[model samples]
Target: MDLPRAFTIRESSHRVCNPFTTEKLALLGRAISPSPGTRMLDLACGKGEMLCTWARDHGVSGTGVDISTVFLSAARARAAELGVADRIGFVHGGAAGYVADDPVGIAACVGATWIGSGMPGTVELLRRSLAPGGMMLVGEPYWRREPPDQATVEACHAERKDDFLPLPELLRRFGELGCDVVEMVLADQDSWDRYVAAQWLNIRRWLDANPDDELAAEMRAELAASPVKYATYEREYLGWGVFVLMNH
Candidate 1:
């Protein structure tokens, strides 16, 4: 019904929750250049930034589903702020296995691909809601470089080295899924900093206001440890991007 308190606290200030800045997001939207009136389905659509912005810039209509009521509220407000409220809908529910009533011009499972277990399953789930010839957008992380050790892998927030593929192999994965790699907008180190570094501020602010909260200690420890961890491992080893794919 709602996201974990930790997640909500960490991302409370984020409009787009992945390692993408506003420029990269705009670049991705323009690259795809969804035709006016195109329909989109975005699963686990954090704060509905993609759909709302597309509705404003490209005139696309869409539905965004997420389990977090907090994010859904932010999404609705964003739609209104962007004056695209009529063009998009926000649903507070689990995104896993959810499909649109009709095939859409774009179907996406960004960042939260765990909804379908992994990349392949998430791609299949998106395909179920995509119209013929429509594109699918997947936001995923890849290994920027092979980690030198298990400690590095763990520092990068991966359980194992295989948790993410190198960039070339990741593209090959789309091919394996029977999709063409049509377009992609990748996150640079600065973008990753924007995504990860901003969380510290949000968590710090939350801690200041709610010192007695049960999660405060955890947030403080994360705030203390995250910067070193990110700069050391994730910034160098992990890369994230939103890839556009088409059925082959």
Candidate 2:
């Protein structure tokens, strides 16, 4: 009834599960403009930051579902801190097969398409919880520019060969899912920095406090190598965004 242990590690490390900064996430949250009183569902809602913020600003009620108990607990505390404890609920369960209890005006699976096998399957998962005319939001990654070479793609954490499509092609894949892209908020370098670099500081502090923990070795190695690898590869080439969609 919890997300895998890897998720807990990532959260403890202050790392984003995906390359979305709080600002970029807020931008996507604002872009959709959920109707007043409309209900929303956030699948794979890591720490529930996006849902809590949206509930505070947009006058909507919702539930956030995640497999990570650690994140669910943090999300619950966050909702309380924001004085929206009753407005948003956090559930600790796998998002892969979960649907909203009620038809929602917006159903989102931000940066967790793998929950449904891939982007298209994730849209189908979201669609089940969406009311007619409701928006479905999917966050995904794409190349900022055509790869200069195979090495560049690999540097971005993608396979050296063709693993991801270009930006337009990625959107086209969504169209093939019977959805129309309604709105989108893309992440820039600044946002990416917040998402990635901030984690380095958090990881460093965690390492200091838990110097001899069994996981320290792995964390330390990742912390030591990630900045160099991310800056050299992902920072320059990979871009991420959340797209709002409606059934075509």
Candidate 3:
């Protein structure tokens, strides 16, 4: 029901649980520019950065649902820190089957689409809570370039080459699903580095402070291999973006 301690540890410093920088995330908010008092529901909303920041910047209000108590705590703290505590709420719960009782202006599942099994299922789940003319925000990875072999796929943390599509095909998928791709903000290599490289520092710092912790050995091994693996495979082959969609 919760994210593993290892994952929480690795992403301890992340404001958003994906490969997006604060600047880029703000860009998305500005790009969409939701009106004041817009209501939103964000599923699997790790740390609630988007809700808090958007509330502060765009005057929106929302509820965020997440499985991780740790993340929810951070999210609450962030809401307070951003002076949007009254504008946003965070709930600790399963996101897969959760839907807002009332339709919302925005429905989102960013970087945790597995909560709804995959893209199609996640879109359906989000749709349940969307108001007419409302938008959906989906964060996903696509292939920047086709991985040449199974080893490359595994290195990119995918089990199969087909796990992600190229950008054009992904846009086509949105069309097939009866949504229009209105706007998108993509993650570049630098943003990916910031997101992934921060994990190494967090791991090393945690290991330094808690040498005997049970997960230390595994994290240590990951830290050793992740840098090169990321540079070679994921950085070269994987692309991540948050797409804004409206029903067609």
Candidate 4:
């Protein structure tokens, strides 16, 4: 019912929990420009950054759901800190198959499409909770450059080359699913660095604090190898972005 401790530990300091930086996220909010008081439903809404900030900056209200109790607690605290606690709610639950009781103006599943199996199914699931003419925001990764071989794909943490499509193909996918790509905010290398490199620091800090913890050794090994792997493979080959869509 909760995210693994290792994942929580690694991303302990993350706000968005994806490759998006605060600036990039703000850019996304501005790009989409959801109107004041718009209703949003965010699935796998890690730490509720989008909901909290959008509540504060855009006057939108929403509910967020995540499997991580730790993240949900952080999300609640963040909501309170931003003085938007009254505007947003965070629930502890699985996101998959969890449709909202009421349709919303915006339905989002960012960087966790596996909840619905993949992109197509995830879009379908989001649509179930979307009001007519409402928008959907999906954060996903696509290939920045084609991986040269199997080792490269594995290094990017993809099991197979087809696990992600190229960016153009991904947009085409939205068309195939009966949606129009209205807007998008993409992550650059710096955004990737801020997200992934920040995890290394969080992991290192945790390892130093708990040298004898059961996961310390694993964290240490990951810290030692992650930088090079990221620079060589992921930074060059993987791209991530949040796309806004509406059914045509």
Candidate 5:
């Protein structure tokens, strides 16, 4: 499927729907410390926000790959604004089975594991880019409490047992993938609210400007219904985190 325009517009909007905000970014930085100039790869790097920020702050060079044309344009603009275009690159491509010309010190599939099929597949996907002892970062969601019913999961567009795991099982899955539990930053309800709810205002603004765009109407419909659905369903039942891992 093509990248959704709603996602692209939301990416450029000042909303912080993506998990990589200043707090999360700081946590990710501390977890994946590529040596100076270490090459990094961000799989499904929407809008290149994390890579651009990482390169600028950590002095590492890297590339961000995503299938979203709209987000790629924003990523390019971000790199230019940060003056890191020379040190970093953005590829308009899919993350599934994607690799770099050279080995990278860090490989990440943050919040977009579906690109590699699922969590297990995505771990294998990122490992291909890792040099010996290199790190991989995965962002995922777990169930904070057992959801009372299947409808809650459906509201999040997930099947009853898909895309949501208990935190312990998440760590266990990483261990099964042959990675040590190196570091992790869990997102609380507040952060999850920041991620999902902030989207409403942006979509509202976009809907106001593009009153006639077909996608805007769809977005407006989703936005109007999302807040209550999100709070009662996903937020109450789910847990999320970005975990950094290294081969054992």
Candidate 6:
């Protein structure tokens, strides 16, 4: 099993594969300050950036699971590049029902919470692999401002007004799930740009190389419309963060 071709193509150049920039990611890592030798389990760990980096910076060890072979390959290369190959392992598999064999110091599902259906289920899934008092990291998006209309909501890539909560409500949801909001690092507009804008270039380069590809026209349309759509709707309306939670 693998990720859709469109996803891999759009984010082919991305290391983190989310709205988080390297700085924001590092900030989150430091905020948690995982002790050396801590064990982590990262689900839907795109390109394994967090795992590889933490293994390098904090001397932690982890396993990352993802459905994309392409991303898994990139993840392994990243582990080798950071000289942390021995500290991390990657598996090519679905993350929806996957749990670590051992209770971990940290369990994370970043950006891809749909793997467990939604926030509550995702938290439960992470908890299955979390040791007592260990941290659970969830990366998610919130509405920065309420969308004015259905068109705006659609533009922001939400099916309805409730697709994402505003920041305060998001935190409250964590409380509702019986977790304390321990720490967080948010994505700024610039970081959002780095994540979204870069996709256009990747799509453009791919279109140039594969003009006859079946998805080329679709990608071209997306490339043409994405910048304006992003600047108008997503950049201003969406806020993303990696939040650290501990069970209460």
**Cand. 5 TM to true fold:** 0.94
Assess candidate 4 and give its TM-score to the true structure: 0.99
In terms of lDDT, the poorest run of 10 residues in model 6 is 151-160
lDDT of 6 by residue, 16-121 (tens): 8999998888988888899999999999998999999999999999999999999999999999999999989999999999999999999999998999988889
What lDDT score belongs to each candidate, Candidate 1 first? 0.94, 0.82, 0.94, 0.94, 0.81, 0.94
lDDT of 6: 0.94
Root mean square deviation (Cα) for candidate 4: 0.7
**Candidates' RMSD to native:** 0.8, 2.1, 0.7, 0.7, 1.7, 0.8
Steric clash count of candidate 2: 2
**Cα lDDT for residue 181, model 6?**
100
lDDT of 1 at 57: 95
Candidate 3 TM-score versus the reference: 0.98
Candidate 4 per-residue C-alpha lDDT over 187-224 given as tens digits, one digit per residue, 9 for 90 to 100: 99999999999999999899889999998888899999
Clashing pairs in 6: none
Error of 3 at 228 (Å): 0.9
Cα lDDT, model 4, residue 94: 95
Better model by lDDT: candidate 4 vs candidate 5: 4
Per-prediction count of colliding residue pairs?
0, 2, 0, 0, 0, 0
Worst 10 residues of 1 by lDDT: 154-163
Model 1 lDDT tens row, 1-248 = 78888998999999999999888889999999999999999999999999999999999998999999899999999999999999899888999999999999999988988899888999999999999999999999999988999999888777889988999999998999999999999999999999999999999999999999999888999999999988999999999999999999
Question: Model 3, poorest ten-residue lDDT window?
Answer: 155-164
Question: Residue 55 of model 4: what lDDT?
Answer: 96
Candidate 2 lDDT over residue span 1-248, tens digit each: 66655346545644246777766667776777777787989999988888888888887889988888788788888889889888899877789979887899999998888899878788999999999999998988888878898878877767653556678998898898888998988888887887788778777887898899988899899889989988887888888888889998
- How many backbone overlaps does candidate 5 show? 0
Q: Report how far off residue 58 is in candidate 4 (Å).
A: 0.7
